[model samples]
Target chain A: MFEERLKEVQDAVEAAMQAAIAAFPQSDLRDAMAYAAQGGKRLRAFLVLESARIHGLTDAQAMPAALAIEALHAYSLVHDDMPCMDNDDLRRGLPTVHRKWDEATAVLVGDALQTLAFELCAEPVLGDAAHRIELVKALAVGSGAAGMVYGQALDIAAETAATPLSLDDIIKLQAGKTGALISFAAQAGAILAGADRAPLAAYAKALGLAFQIADDILDVEGSEETAGKRLGKDADAGKATFVSHLGLAGAKARAAELVAEAVAALEPYGPGAEPLRDAARFVIARDK
Target chain B: MFEERLKEVQDAVEAAMQAAIAAFPQSDLRDAMAYAAQGGKRLRAFLVLESARIHGLTDAQAMPAALAIEALHAYSLVHDDMPCMDNDDLRRGLPTVHRKWDEATAVLVGDALQTLAFELCAEPVLGDAAHRIELVKALAVGSGAAGMVYGQALDIAAETAATPLSLDDIIKLQAGKTGALISFAAQAGAILAGADRAPLAAYAKALGLAFQIADDILDVEGSEETAGKRLGKDADAGKATFVSHLGLAGAKARAAELVAEAVAALEPYGPGAEPLRDAARFVIARDK
Candidate 1:
C-alpha cells in the first residue's frame, strides 16, 4: 500500500517538474536540466506528499512542495557529479549531466535548477505567503552552508585528512549532508497544516540518520548495478562511513534501532502516519 | 555626491554580506563564499538601496533586498569565473574564487551563495509576509531559468554557433542576461514601499542596455587595468558585441542615447531621481 502511494507521489512530482522546465528555451543546458531532474527515486517527494496526505492535504496542495524538494535534490546531484566534485560518470543509470553535456552546461543547469526549487516553493497554492516563505527558508537552511553544503564540505575535507572520522564525526556529517533535507521533507505536512512540527521533526531526525546508515550499508555490500551508481566508493577512497565505524552486523542493528525510533516518533500522529512509519522500515530493508 | 552614496551603500552591503556568511562553518567553502562576495562595485545593491531611499524607505527596510542582490551577483560571478564556465583567473583585481581555492570549492560556494541570496530575501525586515514573498518571487524570476540563466545558456550556445549574434539578438540576450536583475534591483524600493514599479522598471530597462553597451565599448577600448579583469575578451573570442556591430564611436553614441532614455524615465520623480539618473549616466561613463 505504501509502495503504491510512493509511486503516486513520484509520478505527480515528475509531471510537475516536466511542466516547470517546459518553458525553458531549447539548448544543451535546457536538455541537460530536464535530464538531470528526471528519474530520481523521488524519495524526498514521497516524504513530503505522504506527510501532507496524513495531515489531510491533497496532492494538488502538496505537489509543489514535493516538486521543490525533488528539484533541489536533482540540482545537488548534478553539481555533486561534476568533475571537480564526485567526478561521477553515471546517475540514475545514465550519464551524469557533466558527462552528457560539457561541465559548463552542467554547472548552469545546476544553478538554474536550484533557483527553480525556491521558485516552486513560492507557489501561491502552498497556503499563505507566510507558509510559502517558511518553505523557502527551511529548504535554504536545509541545503545551504549550515546544512547539506556544510556536510559536503566536511566530507571533502575528511577525504584528505590524515585520520579517518570517528563514529560521532561520521554521524554529525551524515546528519548535515543527508538528514537535513529529509528532515525538511518530513516536516512539510506540519508546516503546511500549521500543526505542531515537534512529532514530525522527531520522526524526521531519526529517519534521516537511519536512511544514511542504510546508504552506508548499501555502499559496503551493494553492487553498482543494484545501487544504480558507483558503489563501495567510501572503502575505496578510505573515507570513514557508518558501516566502517559500526561493522556490518553492528551497523544493521543500529539502523534497525533508528528505524524503530523513527516509527515511534510518529505515535502522536496515530495511524495517519503509517506510511511514514513504513517509509522508515523501507529505508533499511531495500537493497538500494 | 552619487559616488558618496554608492560608497555608503557598498559599505553597508559588504557588512551585511559578511555577517550573513560569518555564521557558516569554518571551511574552504565558507572562505571562498566570503571572498567571492567581497570587493564588487555593488551597483545592484546601490540601485536597491537608492530606489528605496527615493521612495522614503529606510536603509533597514531595504538593506535585506540590497544584500540579497549583491549575494546573487557574487554567486553569478563566482560560477561565471569557474573553469567550466568563463575560466577567468581574476575578478575585482584579485584571484577568482576557483583560482584561489579549486573548481569544486567554487561550484559549492556558488551554489551556497545562491541559496543564501534567497534566504536573505526571506528576511522579516523586507516587510510583512507578503512583501518578503514578493521579493523572493521577483528575485527568483529575475535570476532563474527564464531570466539570467536563460541568457547565460544562450550565451554559451552563441559561443559555438555557426553565425554570430546580431545587434538585435545581442539586445534581447542582454535584456535577459543583464537587464532582468537590474530591473529587479531598480524596482526594489518600489516593491518595498508598495509604490508603483513602472517608473523604476522603465529606468532600469534603459540603464541595463546602456551598461552592456558600455561594457562592450570597454572591451574594445579599455585596458585590463581600467576594466579590473580581462579586456578585449569578446574580440579575442571573436564573439560579436555592441562595438562590433556598431563601431566603437557608434556604441558610445547609442549608450549615450540609452542613458538619456534612462534619465528621462525618472522625470516623474523630479529632483528625487537625480541620483538614479546619475547612476544611469555612470553606467556608460565609468571605467570599471
Candidate 2:
C-alpha cells in the first residue's frame, strides 16, 4: 500500500515541478531551477497532496499547493548546499546548484524559487481569499525565520558548542529545521480541506516527528549509494542525532513510535485518511 | 514643501513600525528585532507611505504596506552587512546586527525580518484578499532572486571583473538591487490608492531611478557623520555607481531629470499627487 502511495505522490511531485518550471520565461534561471528540483524525495510535496486527499481535495485542486511546497523545499536545499552553509556538492547523485553553476547563481536560483513558492500560493486556483491567506501564513511560519531559519541557526551553533547536547536539544533543533516545514505542508492541505485547527495541528505535529525520525535513521545506517548523500556526515561533524541520543535500537523504536502516533492522529478523519497512514508507515520504513 | 512631505512620511513610518512590533509576543526575538529596526533612515518605509499619500490612501489604510516595505529594507541591510556579503560593521551609526550579535544571530534576525515583511503584507487589516495577494506578489518580485537577488549577484560579480561598466550596465544593476524594491513600494501604494497599472508602473520606474541617484550622491560627498554609513566605500570597492559612470555633475543632473519625470507621471492625478512629487525631489536633495 505504501509503495503504491509513494508512486502516486512521486508522480504528482514530478508533474507539479515540471509545471512550475514551465510557468517561467526561458532564461539561464530556468535550467538551473529545473535541475535543482529534479531529484528530491518530495516529502513535503507528498505530505501536502496526502493531507489534501484526507480532506477530499482532488489532485487537480491540490497540485498548486504541492508544487509550492516542493519549490520551497528545492529552494532551501539549493541554499543549504552552498559553501557558506552545508557545503554539500552532491544531492541525489546530481551536482548541487552551487557546484553546477557558481555561488552567485545558486543564491539567485534559491531566491527565485523562494519567491516562486509564495507567488504560486497567491494564485487564484487555491480555493478563495481566506484559504490562500491561511496557506501563505502556514508556509511563512514553517519555512521562514521563525521556523526553518531558527533551526538553521541552531544547527550552526550546535556544530561549535563546547558541550554535548541532550536528546531534547537534538529534537528541538530538528523540530524547527525539518519538522516545522513538514508541519506547514500538512497544515496547508488541512486548511485547504477546511479542517479546523485542532486536528490539523495534531496531525502536523505527528507527521513532523515521524519524518525527522526517518531522516535520523537514514543518516545513521543508509549507504551513500542508496541515500545519494555522504553517509555518517552527521557523526563526523559531531552533530547530535537520534542515533546518538538513543541507541541504534532505540532510534529504530522511536521511529516506529512516531509512525504509530502519526497514524493515530489520522483517526479523526476516518477512511479518508488512508494515504496519510500509508505515508507515516513509509516514512519509518524507507531505506533512503 | 518637500520637507513637510518628508516629515509626514517619516511620522507615518514610525507609527507603522511600532504597531508591527506590537503584534509579536515579547521575547528575545522581539528585543533583537527591535534593535535591528531602530536604526535606518526609514527611506523605504517613507517611500511606501508617501506613495500611498500621493495616490490618496488614508494614513490608517497604508500602514500595513508601509511597515512591510520597511521590514524588507531592514532585513536586506542586516544580511548585506554579514561577513559573507558586504561585511560592513556599522550602519546608521550603530554596530550592525552581525557585529553586535554573532553572525548566526544576525542571519536569523534578517530571516525573521524577511518573514515579517510578508506577514505584514498578508495582514487582514491591509485590504481585501485580492489586494493582499497583489501586495505579496509585488514585494516578492521586488526582493526575490529575479529582482534584488539577481542584482546582488551581478554586483558581486562586477567586483572581480575587468569590464568597465557602461550606462546600461549600471542601470541594470541598480534597477535590480535598489530600484526594484523602491518600485514595489510605489506600485504597492498606488495599488492601495486604486491607481491602474500603467500610471503606477510609470511612477515606480522614475521614482526608483531617482532614489538610486540620491544614494549615489550620498556615497560620494555625504559625511559619515551625516549619512550614518561610511562614505566613499562605493569608490573604494570599485563597484559601479551612477556617480562613477555618469560623473558627479552628470549624475546630479540625471537625478533631477528622474525627479521631473516622476512628477510628470503623476500629473494625471493633479495636486493629489503632491506628496510623490515632493518625495521625488527630496530623494535627490536629502543629506543622507
TM-score, per-candidate, Cα-based = 0.98, 0.90
Task: Please give the distance, in angstroms, between residue A8's alpha carbon in candidate 2 and its true position after superposition.
Answer: 4.5
Give fnat (model 2). Answer: 0.39
Chain A of model 2, TM-score against the native? Answer: 0.96
Write model 1 residue lDDT over B61-166, tens digit each, in one string. 8898998898898899899988778889889999998888888889889999999999988888888777788888899899988889888888888998999998
Candidate 2 local lDDT, B1-288, one digit each (tens):
766656676776776676676565444555667778774666677667766766666767878788888887887787777776777888888888867876656655766677777777777777677778778878887887567766776677677779767779878878888888888887887666556757767877988888888888888888898777778888888777888888999999998998888889887778877766777777888887
Index of the highest-DockQ prediction: 1
Measured on C-alpha atoms, candidate 2 has an lDDT of 0.76
On residues A1-288, what C-alpha lDDT tens digit does candidate 2 reach at each position? 767767777887787787777665455566788888786677777778777877778777887888888888888788777776788988888888878887656755776777778877877777876788778777887876567766776777677789877888878878888888888887777788667756657777876776787787788878888787767788888777878888789988988887788778778888877777777777877777
Off by over 4 Å in 2: A18-31, B1-33, B54-57, B160-162, B193-195, B237-240
Regions more than 4 Å wrong, model 1: none
lDDT score of residue A249 within candidate 1: 96
RMSD to native, candidate 1: 1.1
